[model samples]
Target: MNIAIVASILTVLVGLFYKGHKNWLMTWLQNFCGSLFVFSGWVKAVDPLGTAYKMEQYFAEFESTFSETWMSFVAPMFPWLSEHAILFSVFMIVFEIVLGLMLLMGAKPKFTSWAFLLLVVFFTFLTGFTYLTGYVPEGVNFFEFGKWGPYVETNMKVTDCGCFGDFLKLKPKISFLKDVFLLFPALWFVFRHKDMHQLFSAGVRNLIVGLSIVGLTVYCMSNYLWDIPSNDFRPFKVGENIGIRKAIEATAASNVPVLAYELRNKETGHVVRVPYTQYLKEFQNYPKEEWDAEQIRGDQTITVVKDANGRASILKFYEEIPAEQLSDYLTSHFELTGDTTVIPIATTKISDFDITDMDGNEKTWEVLQTPNYSFMIVAYKLYFEEGQENRMVYDTTYTYDTIAIEGTDSVYVERKVADVQARQVSQSVYDFDDDYVARYTEVVNPVLEAAQKEGVEAFAITAYGDPAMIEDFRHETQSAYPFYLADDIMLKTIVRSNPGIVLLKNGEIIQKWPYKQLPSYEEIKANWMK
Candidate 1:
């Protein structure tokens, strides 16, 4: 639903009841603004890690922007911010909730107005940067406008700001517009806070706001920081079937009725219509995936077109012209947007959910499609090369002297005198993740063994660490299973733990455990698996 339409309806309702009253407008504005803030904050708090990941994305994009603009000094700051994004995510969640509640109850009108205004402005800036930077040409800095080129959809820095978390999908442009729209009420409350209607007694409002903050803190901690979100909104959430969902999506996407959009060349500003029926028939003639090398070599079997960046490719296959002059026969064509209808991988429940072995063979279907249950150990990273340092140690030395214990042993007696000094020392020991490897060994290893004993197939998948590192981790932790390769971001999405456990039965995710609270396999089998 368009928020603007809802606001209009709310305006009409408020006017119908409280016509001609000066406070009526303020009353509606405050209520609506407070509601939006509360709702947005609440959704984000449900999955705090998702918001943190989005923050990390923005920081990374900003880092790239800084580097592209030759601001090398400013680039380092983004990595630090990315590291603490989760903490910032939690803080922002709580702050938004508290201030929104305060605004709704008219507890601190002046403070809430200022905070809301600042927040909206900051959000507008972020969204504006994301939406506007598309107009900046390739190899051009976003801040430098003189060389800015025509609008290109492919140059967006950050795709979505995650304003409403995963509950709603707002494009970069739409998010910018939404924040811009909120500025009206935010500014009104800033200068005209005196006109705001008061609600509830002072003590009662205090109690409500205090409880809200406490609740939000606990909620964010439990959801992302300490453990997996209680309510999982991600595609890899428990009970999700990757294979089945993709199959279902493919079936649905095949028949989606679509009309070909008119092709427009941004550089030339030339627009042309595509014959809908002709395109609908021709687009279906070729396979949608990568084409054969032979066909792409010179077979006159493909139509070529240049992308928005002026890179030439096969119209259907999107093949780059071979550097070795493999193809000589090529026909140029105009690319049409919305020419064919298919569900984008992004819109589906599963996108980058792939499982590949070290040898580069896909195992996604073989794993998920099996009828028997299996266990997956997802280790996104396992680097711990920097060993513990600055450990306090006592340096002791002993010396023997003939004069010691003279009374007891007479002339030949020798006693040992000890001297001890405290020193800080660094040790290079096992560097297998100081944070969670011990936990994985103590908690997850046992579960893997138990699963093996129960005749269940289990394996490990990781995004980081080479084969040597994997072997070192296995030897150090006594893990006997083989490890496959997977995308790090996807592994994080699979489970919140670095080395989390995922149980699957015939394509459906049965259960997932973060590294912090990995249960015994027997307990899992007796409870969820059985």
Candidate 2:
């Protein structure tokens, strides 16, 4: 049944129930929406940077989709919006949580109802656009359905909508459908907002919600600004074994292909498609005249896998390999090589977890696959824009000039001309809290020295950027461990701190710590080294 029809039937039933038990139904609806909002906001609040990154993805998609048309007027603004994505992320999360609290407490029901309606409407539009664009290919007008080919699938630029953060990923279609269902309650609250019952007095309810907003805001800031999330929801979280995940991925990739094969005859130019199993079965005893004349065509593989939105996709592959050489090819390409081959059967979470040295040498397998404990210090960026230093440079030059007076004919005089030239100078500055750096050095240096004594490896990984900046940081801190390079996004995924610590043992994440939580040398020696 259509969602609208279902919603209409539910509304009629709800109306009938309200006639008999209006107070109970209104209270129930308020609590239900309030709980949902709280949950949604809490997940986002726990990982605000994740939400910010999602926002950046949305902004990038928007810019990419609208950059070359009449909508180009808004294209330039996306980069700026992406830059401040974290600020918007923080505000939205706080607002949602506070609104949830207000609704639950029945504080300012009139305002709450209006705000809720507006929020729902905005979300409905967002999710609607997200769903409709699946059919709209790139560089085509969104509303021009005639130009859109058959609605085979979503060609959406932004994949995940980031509605429930990392905890729950909803597909564009499902997300749109969910918003449609939510509209019923939203409309209900619009008309029956006054039916909301207050849990406390006006002053007490205001104070409660206000305190909640402040408390959650502080909690989010503490996690994002100063340290890693108290709870890690990523694939690299502690206790996850990379080797085991690799094995699972390998198994998934080894599944049989879902597509059959088509072969064309060289002499007759006739083509025939047969089931993959049947083709393999007949290959050995096939007649030489027919078999030798057969040329593969439309050979492909179809694999089904679930996306982040939990939607199954019939992923197609067009690459072809001869059946006779397939076994040899697999052995030569995948068996000996350490590189993991991605198949369409499943997604590997840690596929992109790689490490490289400054010279562009990969050391991922060496560090992660070895049966030893290692300390990886992650620093995403060495400098912040806010820490940049500006200076003005003034230059003075003297020049001798000859000029003739108006009344005097051919009268030339030597005069010294002074010119003052000013130029703006700017330099990247590292203002990474000198006291924090000092404390970090004090705690980490000893641990590194002890790890060396115990034959355990330790190293620092940062994004590929200015070598001079890395050298300066190393020299200033007098860090004993070697510093390697990795992508900043990878470092951020490793830990949500400028400088964080990750303890890995044989590709399994053992523990992770923020800079402020770095353990002492004695503690590391006693617990980890052993």
Candidate 3:
């Protein structure tokens, strides 16, 4: 983090104090490197909530263009990724700071230069793609750089490019142009310097870089750990549009103001107002003995505190509960009958009529039911992940065809499948559902369950826009095990594989299997009965 400061000092020295015509070249390189850090830093620094909101908005429309396989991949993966968004943010911050510092200190010159150059190239490509495809309808037009190309513009509007993670308030046009401009220094950083160690020496150089790094580190810690955004840009700033006090007053006057109150603790006399609607269901009838409800949303309160330019956050005031606490609460409340104990077993299915294999002889598909075996009826939803948007479009099956099986159950499944694929952002996995289904059925499910099953029926549960698809699932696997439709995430979390299975004893899970492996009846019975 302090690397930014080191880079800043080096930039000033090179631009102003350095001797001879060397100043000219040094100034050019310095400004170029400086711009990379300043601009990228700004992009990385954008308001997280605003950035996330923008990304969410894009996904809303993006999800429509994907194949069935692609759609299932995204929905589950996106939420999981978003949950750890802070980790990504931290990584970005450290990356920018270190890169900037390395540039200033002239350390690992070739490697650093190449890395920054590559970064610039990537950004340039992404920005260009965004403009060309119009996938991200917001942000400035990078295509304009080309003298006479398809200036035949598609629909686009003014929105933050989020180049810096919505950290700065720069307009999209400015952000786009600025990022493009920084490519010069990034290029120089790669080409100019031969010996990296010359950039930093044993004495003064070390002190300057070390001091700068320390300062930046302190600044970052103060802002992130203390929940303080830059004083100049924080919402609490004098010219800021939103007001915390006003928000609080608004909440207090209305019964349903999307705000609620909660005590910091039974022992402390602290109270806070939050968007009440967010937690209404969670604490509507909460038994306070075991827990407590607060009027303010935790995130909101922290945001407000930071707005106030407060040094320590209200988060410190509140007793924070670990994630496991919530997990425990959910499990206790749901009384989820799935295996609380670890047992290994897998499920396998075989389509008796081997139409693909051209086995003309009549074959009976067997469904075996045993009291000791756990039964799981899996329904698959195809969601695409990232890096597959174009591929999904070209693949055709995701959008145009019935994602599931046939005409009777086709239309709804098609629409739902397409919708899921269209929702992916870059850096995410794509065509997840298709991959899941293919992998499980072709490889995992079959390999582990080579022994033919008898009297046990398997059915996939999924939803299309129509109720009939679900009904069809019921019809297809009639009177076997009930096909349980679950929220897409629940299904993924239950098993990392598609068409997941569970061994049940009296309707409770005794064993679970991932897609890569399925257990035989004997294996399942051995694990569960004990």
lDDT of 2 by residue, 319-402 (tens): 232322333323432322223333333343465566777677888767776678888888876653335678999988887777
The estimated TM-scores of all candidates read 0.73, 0.65, 0.34
List lDDT for all candidates, in order.
Answer: 0.72, 0.70, 0.43
Candidate 2 stretches with Cα past 4 Å from truth are: 1-25, 125-133, 136-155, 254-348, 384-446, 464-488
* Candidate 3 off by > 4 Å: 1-23, 39-80, 129-158, 164-168, 195-199, 202-225, 230-530
**Model 3, range 26-70, lDDT digits (tens) per residue?**
444654475557556644443333333344434433343222333
> Which candidate should be chosen as best, given lDDT against the real structure?
1
* True-vs-predicted CA distance for residue 68, candidate 1, Å: 3.3
Error of 3 at 91 (Å): 1.7
